[model samples]
Structures are given as C-alpha cells and as structure tokens.
Target: MNLKTKLFGEVYQFGSVKEVLAKANEEKSGDKLAGIAAENALERIAAKEVLSQLTIADLRNNPVVDYDEDEVTRVIQDAVNEKIYNEVKNWTIADLREYIIGLDTGDLELKRISRGLTSEVIAGVTKLMSTLDLVHTAKKLEITATCNTTIGKKGTLATRLQPNHTTDDIEGIELSLYEGLSYGMGDAVLGLNPVDDSIDSVSRIYTLFDEVKNKWEIPTQTCVLAHVTTVMECIKRGVPVDLVFQSIAGSQKGNEAFGFNDKIIEEAYELALKEGTAFGPNVMYFETGQGSELSSDAHHGADQLVMEARCYGYAKKYNPYLVNTVVGFIGPEYLYNSKQVIRAGLEDHFMGKLTGISMGVDICHTNHMKTDANDLEILATLLGAAEVNYVIGVPGGDDIMLNYQTPSYQDDATLRSLFNRHPIKEFEEWMEKMGLIENGKYTERFGDASIFFGK
Candidate 1:
C-alpha cells in the first residue's frame, strides 16, 4: 500500500499500484507515449525499489482492473489456486524474485509457484530482473503442450513456417512452404498469415495446407492465421483446421477491440475440440504483443508489461499449443529499437513459460523501426539460448504480406544446429526419412523446394 521510496536525497512517491507498476518498467516508448512512465532514471529505480517491497497479497488484492469490471482480471484471479496462493501471499516481490532465481529452484518448483502468481506479480518481479536473469530463470523451466506433436522438449526447438503471399497466390504459398519444409522448418505448424481473411480465401488456404500435410504425411500441424470467427466458420464447414488461431489482448476492453469476448474464445475452443483435425487436447494458437492494449486504448492505466503478462494469464485458461509474442511488430512506439525489442522478446518468452504455457517469439522488426537483421539475429540467438519452444520462420525473414522481418528458414536451421537441437521428434524423423538430413546435417536436398514436387 505504501508507494513511496527515497533515492538520491529525494522522495519519489507514486500515486497508486498502477503508477508503481508503470514506473518500474524498463523504458518503453508506449509507456512514455501514455505519459505514465517515470520521468527520470532515479525515479525508475525508486519505483522498482518500492515495488520490490510490496507483498504478493497486495498485488493480488489490487488487480490492475477491478475484478468485477474486467473479465480478464477475473480470469487471472479466479485461476489462482487459493491454497498455493496462501503459501506465497505474504512473500515480498523481491523474495519471489530471489526464490525463482535461487539455486534450489527448478522446473517443478517453478511450475508450482506459477500457479499461485497473478499476472501483476509476474510483471512486478520481471521488472526487477536483469536480462540474463530472465534468460537464466526461463531456461530452468520446461513448459510443453501437445497438438499433433509435443513441443518444448529440453533438447528441441520448433518453428512456425509462415508461407505468406502478398496476393494469396496458392502457387507462391506452395513454393514458400516447400522451401521452408526442405530446410527442416514447420515442425510446430505450417501456418500462414493470409493476405485475405475472407471466408473463401481463408478456406482455400486451409485446404492447401491440409492437402500438403496429408500428401507428404508431414508430422506437423497446419493452420491459416485468420480471425477466430473466420476460422470457426471454416471448422464448421468441415475444413481441415489443425489449430484455431486468434490474436488476443490482456483486458476485456482490449479483447473487445480485437472483436472478441471470452464467450467467442470459449466457443472457438469448443468448436475446435468437437470438429477440428488436430490430434491432441491442445489446439489453440494465440498471438500477443506489448503495447497492443495501449494501441487500442484499453490498457486502463497499467503498464504494457503487466498487460502483456495478463495476455498469458488469459491464454492459460484455454491451454494453447502455441502462444507467441510478436515481439517487435507493433512499431517503435512500443518497443523503440534493437535493445528494447530484444529485451521484450526475452521478457515475453520468460513470462509465458512462467505462466505455464508453451511460448514462442516472433523475433521481428518493422521497416521503420531502428532495427535491422543484426538486431533480430541477436534476439534469435538469445531466445535460442533460452531454449524457447519455437520462433516464427518466414521464407527470408520477411513477411511480404505483413511487411515485417522475422527469422528466416535458414535462421531456424542454423539455430537448431548451433544449439545441437532438433525439431519435434516426429518431424525430425520424417525429415530423415525423406533424406533431407543425414549425419545430423542437411543433405544435398536441403533448400530445394523442387524435392517436394518429386522432380
């Protein structure tokens, strides 16, 4: 309840829990744009100092939005295991941070601790962690989910092969898809970000994905990243939908901005379970990013980091197979440059893992952002080191449709080899069976899209 701290012979007092959370965050353009960020470095540290002393119960009791007013807050609060919550309710934020990073802590204990944490507490502790701290703690946790294949195995990394075309050209998409698969990509899912989200266009793309998946007997899932409604309609029409995709937000208002409520998301999940084509209990794919709520004017005075973490809390209820933060796609207003982008990629991956979800990252940047391939490669290497469940793979790290740069097909292969990691076990075997790999290296057929055409 006390939001005051002394630093450098000055008293820094924040107005409320919201203010403290916002001020303690590392510099972000979105927070500055919102006019809620700390005015100076000393004030930022003061906020962190004050935030570290707050109790878990204090954060839980003061949900970012009133529980009655926001379904997101309700979902986060209602999901907390009360017994587990009680065990850590009195722990200070600093204590929670050290406990997580402590030498004695490992995957199982972290999972247990995750169940008791609200998204606010997660954000609070994250604000106090250094970049390496995020990586070290995240690397210690193992979170995996099964759709067609299990992902996030300790020695494995995965990629979502995004074969997007500027004009929804099936041939172009096919060419890109074949190229990506030849490089041993698409173990997570052969998902496309359609230039067209219409029913006809979306359905046609899904049909293509289905046919290719069946024809090659690829040991992976497929999807078109259309809106949830269009995807639900496709499923209702008996289209092959291995996974349901949606871009979700942290607050109910923000979700509304995305044109969905919990009801729609629940309906989509139920429909996928009853009618979709995946093999598992996990079949949802969610995308979240920092600054989305602020962009939509739905942040409700909370920092983007807290809002981002709430996204994980909301996604947790549905048990998504893939939940990736499109880390740098929201432009420089939210993430600014390379340093902030890399920091957010690590933060999101770490938070998603701690929230008990299979998390990935789209290590990306837009054209106008002060970033380039070098920055993205640095981030990809860091996430690779953190043992992320997956990262997005486009043909050349450029989504012609979305107009952003992500990891390329070659980048994914290099990451796996560099880390001595493999794709999902089944996909790896399939690649081996197809002679795409030998002696743990790509064979002569690698990068040849023509191979899938039997030429």
Candidate 2:
C-alpha cells in the first residue's frame, strides 16, 4: 500500500488530479479560457518535483541563499494580490489533501520549495472557505503561561509565571482554580519554562502535570512541556519537550549559566529520540526582542539569522521531530509601543523561515488592559497571515483578576459581549473562518459536562 492508503485507509481516495481539475474547469467555464487556465495549473503542479536528495550544505546554504527577497515578497504578494491581471487561483480541499500526500510520500522536497507555496496554500484555503460559506462558528484560541524563576517575579495570569507555589499549593489551585478559568473561557495550552532551577523546576512541573492530568484530566498531547533548563533532565524523565535557549543573552556575556549552545540543543534531540520523546527548539523567544538590546528591526533580522543557522544545523545533524518558536514579550520594553510588539512578532516569524516550526507565534504579554480589541484583532490577523501554527493568551491577565472577590466573565454576558466584539471575537472568527477549529470547537464537541465531570 502507498503511504496515503496506509495512513488514511482505502476510503481516502476521492478522485484523480486530472479529473478534479476537469470538473472544476467545467463548473466555472464554457470558454476555452477556463480549460487553458486549469491545464496550466495542472502542468505547474506536475512539473514541480516533490522529492530531492539534500546535503548538509544545501540545508545550511538555503537560509542565506540571498535571492532577491523582493522576489519572494512578490510571489506572496501576488498570491494575495487582487489585480485582474495578477489574480491567483485558490485550491480545493481535495487539492490540499493531495499536496499534503505528496509531501508525506517524499515526492516533494519540502525545504527546497519556495516558502511562498505555504503562504499560497493558506491563502487558497481561506479563500475557498469564504467562497463556499462553509466556515465554522466555533472559535479556537491558545493561551500559554511563561514562568521565569530567574526574574524573581511570576507573570500575570495569562503570561504569569508559575508561582514558586509548593507542589501541594499548585495541585490544590491549578485544577479547580486555573483550569476552569482557562477551559470555561477558551482553548488553552500551558507552557512551562523551567529555567536553571532543576530540582524545583522538574518537581513543580511534574506536580502541575499530574494535577492537570489527574484532577482536570488534560490529555498529555494537549499539554506542551517546554524545558529551558538542562536537556539531561528531559532525557532522564523521558518527557516530550521543547528546548528553549534561555541562556543565549548570558552566553553573549561569556556566561554558560543559562545559555543553550548548539551542542546542547543537538544532544537534547538525540536523547529525546532515544527516549521516544519529540524534541524541537524554541529559539525565537530567547534571541529576539529587548532581551538582546537590539532594535526591533535589527533584533528581528539578527534573530532570524541565528534561528535559521541553529535550525538548519540541527535539521542537518538529526532531523528534529518538529520546530517551534515563541512570540511573547522579551521584557517590559515592548509595553512602550504596541506597534513595536507587532513588528517584533512579524520579524521573529521571518527570521525562522516559517517552516518546520510547529506551533510558532505566541503572544508573550497580552493581558494588559491597554491591549485594545483592535490590537488583538490585528495580532490575530497577522498571525493568521503569517501561517503561524498557534497563538497563546489569557482572557484576563493582571488587568482582570478572576479571584472570588472579582467576578469572572463566565456569568457576565455583557463582559463576554465586550470580548466577542473586538480582538477576542475577531481572533476567534478569523480562526473559524480559516477552518482552524481545533481550539475553538473543544466545548461544542466535548460539552460542558466534561469540565465538571469527565463523563
């Protein structure tokens, strides 16, 4: 059996590419123009070879290939460009499935293909859904918490640090307190950053995981365990983990304390594979933003170079299971200008070359009351346009405390309406419109009963 048959079973094949193209052409046109256009598209699809043998040098050199970036920009621009002469066609679900199959079968060389193809695919899917009016109603959102022990301060609720709360305290509060807040409102994935404090970090993380797993019953797959400390702990514990470069800034100062060097990253992957755990780098968070004191533009450019180099190097060394990046606040400096935050995020994505990064582009500090609905909508749109895999945020950060004294938005339809109007609603709507339904449809499919009682 072929790869697709093996994965999708015998019922998977819908139609041949040629037949589907012919039908599409016939549905749209009585003139030869449609037929000619369909033929050209078919030819383009066939002419592009799917698979190619790659050398370490090819992977290393691709990031710096220095093609007119304008050319790349133009390709993507043309995909979205609306001029009559510059129109780009959209692909159907069938077409997308076939393309994914081609990639899976090693018929397409993923790395060599223009990143523009990814953009085109996303745009095509978005347009197709709009044209069909088949968009879903439920919205999906990802909320991540970043805890930095070194800073001596926990993050706010959404991006808040995991308190140095003891294992017991974490267990007592995490499931009943935070889980409801996260689940009652939106789709959430907690990101634990265990920086330097190994014993305490691992113990607390394991405890939190246990509470989430046993008490709340969160699936292991849904929870992302990101380790910013040593890789050996990850290996010893046999946990699928994301490796973050927390010590990069310190490394620049000739301090090895928290830095994740190339060797360590490589070792993490090798060990992960041996232990049957997925491993990927979280470089975008450490290298970009104010942490390095680089200007937003400069920081983005330099960070991309560094991420590409490291990602390419690692991919060359030992094909990673996945590639991931974090798009959150580097420090308090970003609070000064929200535009800078948006710019920094876009730049962070460009630096990563937008491939193999599973779950890229998370909002670092999005809880402040000053973060308007327009800004949130913009952030959602930007993340969607960039083809970012996921985004994380809290419904009420420091701004909207959800303690017993403070009323939760759950009961307030007015507050929920406020959320539904601007960025919150826009983000959810955009995801649904684009057919990214994983996060949003959780409640609809599972029902509220699962939250209170697992049945």
lDDT of 1 by residue, 277-365 (tens): 99879999999999999999999999999999999999999999999999999999999999999999999999999999999999999
Q: Provide the lowest-lDDT 10-residue window in model 1.
A: 97-106
Per-model C-alpha RMSD: 0.8, 17.6
What TM-score, computed on C-alpha atoms, does each candidate reach? Answer: 0.99, 0.44
Error of 2 at 244 (Å): 7.9
Consecutive 10-residue window with the lowest summed lDDT within model 2: 147-156
Residue pairs with backbone overlap in model 1: none
Please tell me which predicted candidate would have the highest TM-score against the true structure. 1
TM-score of 2: 0.44
lDDT of each: 0.93, 0.31
Candidate 2: tens digits of C-alpha lDDT, residues 227-287: 4444457446654333323323211221122344445655654554455322222212232
Model 1 accuracy (lDDT, Cα):
0.93
